[model samples]
Target: MSIRANLDVVHERIARACLKSGRDPAEVTLVAVSKTFPLERLQAAADQGQMVFGENKAQELDEKATAWTSSDVEWHFIGHLQRNKAPVVARHADVFHALDSVRLARALDRRLEEENRTLRCLVQVNVSGEQSKFGLDPSALAPFLEEVAQFERLRIEGLMTLAAPTDDPEHVRPQFSLLRSLLSTPAPGGNTRLRALSMGMSGDFEVAIEEGATHVRVGSAIFGNRSYQ
Candidate 1:
């Protein structure tokens, strides 16, 4: 299917999921995962009014950020960000979706401070305890945020997680639920700024939305299968 048609289907699914959960569809932001896709495909989606795009690589994101000058487009860095690439990501990304470590945060913070800009970020949680996944343990979120709060250039917007891969989305619903619960937890000040839940992707975004995902990163479903080397 064409990108526009795919987007239509995805949006419809999101709306249906929201209806089932008794939530507003507007509350969910679709981050079209454009990582590894060609510029033409990305442009195709952009032409269809897709404003938010997610990239899993810092270099790819920077290249796209440089090419797409539209103020309407939001670049989200959703991959495992390394300290060395922090400068590129800090300069380009409107939001960082997989902030999983203090060391990486410090690196990004320093770069953002140099540019004199704040980067909105989501703390990634290893809800499924997968060794292959890169995220902070669920128990470490508060302390991680405490340390991250000291970095004036970083804004702790919310949480993100990749549910364990499964053919049945229901199998990973608990991971999504755990993330939602974490987002609702009040900070020490009795109020929480963590309103964003950057969970979900092409395969299981509908389930993620029902479990309270504020931002869903969708790839293949919209762009088709990625041409990986």
Candidate 2:
């Protein structure tokens, strides 16, 4: 299937999921995960009306951002960001999805301040308690949010998480639900109205959408399998 065809199917699935959950389809944003894919593939999706693209590596994101100058094309840095690469991400990404530490948050905040820009960020949580995943533990989320609030340039948009990889999508439902439940817990400074849940990937996005995912990151479903050189 073509990228456009795959995107159409994904959109249809999202709509059905939203209908099942009594939510508006507009509440969900499809972030095509373009990480490890070529720029031409991204451009192909863009031509099909895809505006938001996610990259896992800061260097790849920077290179793509440098090449695609369209104001309509919004880039999201959805990888485990390193502190040293904060400057590149701060300069080019419209949204940072894997903010897991206060130290990284402080680093990104400083860089955003230097660039004179404010970035919308989602605090990533390791809901499945997977040792291999990169996110804050559930118990540490509230304090992390409190500390994150101190950064003026980084707007705390909401939460993000990668469900433990499993063949059955039902196995990951609880993880998504847990992340949703944490959003309502009041932060230290009484700011707890988070509006986005950046959960779900190509395989489990439908389930994530049903469980209240505002943003879904889909890669292979849209662009097909990635090629690692």
lDDT of 2 by residue, 1-229 (tens): 9999999999999999999999999999999999888889988999999999999998999899999867898899999988999999999999999999989989998998899998899999999988999999999988788878888888887999999999999999999999999888676553334779999998899899999999999999999887787
Superposition TM-score, candidate 2 onto the true structure: 0.97
Q: Write the per-residue lDDT of candidate 1 for residues 102-203, one digit (tens) a residue.
A: 899899989998998888889999999999999989899887777776777888889999999999999999999999899765554322269899998888
lDDT of 2 at 121: 90
Mark the regions of model 2 whose C-alpha exceeds 4 Å error after superposition: 188-193
* TM-score per candidate, chains pooled: 0.96, 0.97
- Candidate 1 regions exceeding 4 Å error are 186-192
Worst 10 residues of 1 by lDDT: 184-193
Global lDDT of model 2: 0.90
Error of 2 at 5 (Å): 0.8
> What's the distance in Å from true for residue 112, model 2?
0.8
The deviation in Å at residue 120 for candidate 1 is 0.6
